[model samples]
Target chain A: MANFPENIVPSEMKNFRISIDDFIEAYNKGEAELVDIRVPMETKVWQVNFGLKIPANELPKRLDELPKDKLIAVACPHTDRSNMARVYLAEQGFNVKYLVGGLLGLMERLKGGMAKDINL
Target chain B: MKEISFDDYLKSFDYDERKAMKIKLNEMLKLYEEGKAEIIDIRFKDEYEAWHLGFGKNIPLNELPNRIDELDKNKTIVTVCPHYDRAEIARLFLKLKGFNARYLTDGLLGTVDYLRGDKARDYIAKIKGES
Candidate 1:
């Protein structure tokens, strides 16, 4: 995991944690946007609904294309790239939230027979 | 092979020492039931359809990059393959690419083994419904 400075932000911001249920709820309500940070090649085998592509390396230059006002949730095949992106955006003064556990986390949530109940 | 520096080698230590998730098959079954994790079948399309764990996503490692958009990034992902080599490689690749990924130690058959028992049937049933 990436290390964060002890006093990087106020307690509330520092302790912010997004759960799978929260993502599903937002997705179900169509209030959140899911952006996949994995490269195009990685997205071919399996993909989520309404998910967009913007590889992690290209995120910095493509910032303008993203909706700043909307609740943006970024993810990668794994959490490492997404975490890095989250930290980068947070540093740049953008209020973007990352999907915890990455794609795997979502799958886990779905496999336990909660697929239909997925908020989105 | 080209000569490598010690620092570079040290930095790559995690990649070299990578191992599968240490959880037991039964535990994985429980987690699956609780929607806490998902099984990912990393075999090729043909190999996967012939026989799979019954609950994991069939995402061929080579095809992962192109189809990555289909995955829900908020969940935990555990990749499974015949042995664990490809899954480990895929895990490292995803880590480098920024995903929270892990390789399943039990492989596809292990999941099947867990599913065969009465205790894991409900979990297996749940997985089947989702897939």
Candidate 2:
């Protein structure tokens, strides 16, 4: 079993999440790295076109693949799994935050002609 | 190998599918005590650490792929989460992968609410005493 994360306290949780808008802004500036944490079964149905594809369960062994300098923005279809990953990453000492609205909301934001905002 | 496709799973959806996809909390508890069910809490590890049902295995939804081997094929597999949403997701995935799986329709919190105080103690004592 994995050890419980060391970020349960309120003071540490204040910076646990980021809004979709802020994430988009950071994406444009290349100041953040988005990690899609969906499982293979779910990813087979719907998926994001860009971002690092790392399953949450495989993250412990894949830490070297992540960039330490950039702000790591972890996301799943919803906020649930991303929040879990954020706690784990924080304890491992990475600058991280979960996307508030999640990957589903992120995709929804980029729908229609608004995709150009991120140069997609 | 991928045993079943999403389209096939969706194509088979109907009233019978709905009935087959879920297991009530009481039935789940009974089957678990009878050694005929394996309850998997499919929430994340952090959520499991914060609080949990104190029984069943805590396998996060994302980890289900790697941990499939840990599950027993002979027993009924029941997936659970805070609400029924994630549980449903895990159930569908397990079913597609060929496990006789079901979601907790009343949910894990609902199960916890049902087994409070005297009910919880009696249930625990019975299981332990029987074993």
Candidate 3:
């Protein structure tokens, strides 16, 4: 693994937070790539439309499979796991960002009526 | 083989960024009730079928990719395993692949509690009696 820039540390991760609305907007506009770090099974139960599935444990070996140049957004059931993956990807020098509220956060936003018309 | 330090083993599993979104348990409950979120039982098929949360959808970790298309991308997803570790690993993988996902912090049984509401305790008691 490579050393991360001081700004990239998750302790300093605030700069990378992306809200559910922004994520959905980007996805809709095809401006960002969504990466789901959950295992395959959970994804089969529910997931974001068009989001890619790549388990965290398998990410290291499968690094080559991802598009190196795209702006990738990572998400998990919560933020912690995805944060770790974000840190790892950042360390590996990939252009990556993580969802701020995770799926739960997104659901919360939707339920709160903040982005009801977004269609997830 | 020589022993490896826990720290070293942990290091081997290290990834680059560490950003995370914070969500409370109460919020998760509301999502479940609204039908926007699905709790997944990420255990082997046999173990999942033998016993699991009433609402948990069984999806073995290994078979996730091929079955990915079956899920509704618009919904929230929570994964559960015997322990939270496997579920966490699964969550990470799905995030990298760009799926909206999360894992039940309480593991499999915890998710049952969240799903069952106040009935969780009674459910556990009944199971204990049956066993």
Candidate 4:
């Protein structure tokens, strides 16, 4: 994760914090753009089927790779780094959101099979 | 514990009856990834704790009656066990309870085999190719 400024609060960003259920729904509908902000090593074990992996430190240089029109959702192993990414992206003029519980929450949902209906 | 005869167990359900409750692994995986189905492991609690599918809840076959309330009726329920025996029974019971349900054709062992194979790698490569 990148070193975020100490004073940057989540409220400072326009990015929305989305729940795991909503994230899965957006992913299933092909309406969400995901950015895995974890390091490369984290992906070797597991990764979402959709998304580009641009680590938080590398994001500034890789901003050109992200789609401008899509609603971007940043994810990390936990929400802290994704929250940082969200703030950064929002400042860059992109429509962005941070996954509330990040990848761990997603893995839990997958394990429990308890996510709300994707269509609903 | 005395084991029941496999032959006698086979006679418990008719051919078409058994077939209707079974779901192919590929189909279950599809529903799982698409977020349309829930994987419910019907194995013993210890067996599930030892190892089980990465996604889904575990409500052992013996405990299903008491824990049935834990399941969501809105999503398709996919029951799994080491083999299909317990899973099939669980599937039928869930269906009777008015939840859409099916059992993994060969259960957890088959699902593990499938995951261990190249299918997961192929899926990752396919996703990379598209990106």
Candidate 5:
């Protein structure tokens, strides 16, 4: 029921998108990993503490850096870039899910008095 | 007027005792990050849908006993609610049922207040003695 960005075309991949709740559950259980595909400037402003940064443009060249042990939740400022990464990663056989609303949604949820990030 | 009893005066003290039963936010976070504990939100489905901590399972307070089996027996459970009251009750029940558990003393609202006041880093630093 989430409103994904209009720019993203739906994919036929098995690993698709994840809810904030699911992301949280997987993260807390240590069964999930986060990959932020936003560029350096955007990520520098703020980013989830536990997420690994792999700029979208560089992901193909750096895909080997992603962990094979856990499910990957790809995120960007919005769903645009992460969705692309999700499709690409899925094609590459990495178990992946795009963060449904991405980092902007996370910031909104945080600002709206949902839960604060686990640690600074 | 109806009598104002000593029990009324002792009520505040009792509340403090309950507060003492709560797990410190930072300590809970550390335990969670280390995979030593699990955070469980005990609010109703709608309330949970509205907002909740990023890391937790939503098992409404009323649905808990039925779903107790879903929780891990070995890990410490941290129960959460809008305020500490419901979570405390859930913690007590879980404890009686033989699960390792604790309540978030001040609950989700307290966490919001802490964030609004910008005390998160300071509190964590203080707890770790980095401040």
Candidate 6:
């Protein structure tokens, strides 16, 4: 039988969640990648100018497009779907984290005239 | 889990713009009040405690696999969160589990905005009448 990986440990789980501020910092430094996991309809309504747009359902097949070296931050409007995506990516041997509070929080942070603070 | 694929989800998006798989807030309220639909708030327990629509059962996304029996197959399950992202994910899962499910497109935040004044009263009155 083929050997499958075990579940992520409790201690390692803490590292799996990254705050938006931290994500922004890493993202600007080109050390992190954001994956918007929201569906096409939702993205059509509103979307960030940057970030790879792969819906959560499509992640399993579109894994090749993602970079293995950078820290991947999966985000939805909130953390739930991103967390699920993070787990899936982690299992597939990628360094990934669910964006804490997701893209909604990032939008709030980047709202108004402050949008230029984020380099990417 | 069932053998549903990403193509199935993509098909929903590609064909007819997903009008058949999504529910607006007004339609959800009407169907739920009439007992033809059930709302499933698929947020974390903390998020639900922070704010909720006061109807439907709270089933966190991760806990869904364990609590599949709680969902009624007879009624249309409308999965919801603040926005449609998590709700759509839950909807897809529920659909795969052999339940008639749809994502709340207008969203819980939109529903809250919509339920103020007379609209809220009438909806609550219907729920009270049923109970």
lDDT tens readout by residue for model 1, B1-131: 13333223224433223233234556666666677776677667778778766465887766777666666566556767775545654554454445556776666666665556774666656666743
Once fitted onto the true fold, the runs of candidate 3 whose alpha carbons sit more than 4 angstroms away are A5-12, A108-120, B1-131
Candidate 3 chain B worst ten-residue window by lDDT = B14-23
Ranking by TM-score: 6, 2, 3, 1, 4, 5
Interface DockQ per candidate: 0.01, 0.03, 0.03, 0.01, 0.01, 0.12
TM-score of 5: 0.40
User: For candidate 5, lDDT tens digit of each residue in B1-131?
Assistant: 12222222122223333344469777777787667889898877778888876556898776776787899888989988776545755665565566777888667887667654446665555445687
| Candidate 3 per-residue lDDT over residues B79-112, each given as its tens digit | 6676554565456545544556777666665555
Ranking by lDDT: 2, 6, 4, 5, 3, 1
Candidate 5 segments exceeding 4 Å error: A1-15, A111-120, B1-131
TM-score to native of every candidate shown: 0.43, 0.52, 0.43, 0.42, 0.40, 0.62
The digit string of per-residue lDDT tens for model 1 on A62-94 reads: 778776666677787655456545655665566
**Which scores greater on TM-score, model 4 or model 6?**
6
**How would the docking of model 6 be graded?**
incorrect
- Model 4 TM: 0.42
Model 4 pairs in collision = A111-B56
The per-residue C-alpha lDDT of model 1 at residue A11 equals: 36
Stretches of model 6 off by over 4 angstroms after superposition:
A1-21, A35-59, A74-93, A97-120, B1-3, B6-21, B43-54, B82-86, B128-131
Q: Report the number of clashing residue pairs per model.
A: 38, 0, 47, 1, 0, 0
Candidate 6 C-alpha error for residue A61, in Å: 3.9
Measured over the true interface residues after superposition, the C-alpha RMSD of each candidate is: 14.8, 12.3, 14.1, 24.8, 22.9, 7.5
Model 1, CA-based lDDT: 0.61
Between candidates 5 and 6, name the one with more favorable TM-score: 6
lDDT of each: 0.61, 0.78, 0.62, 0.68, 0.68, 0.77
In terms of lDDT, the poorest run of 10 residues in model 1 chain A is A1-10
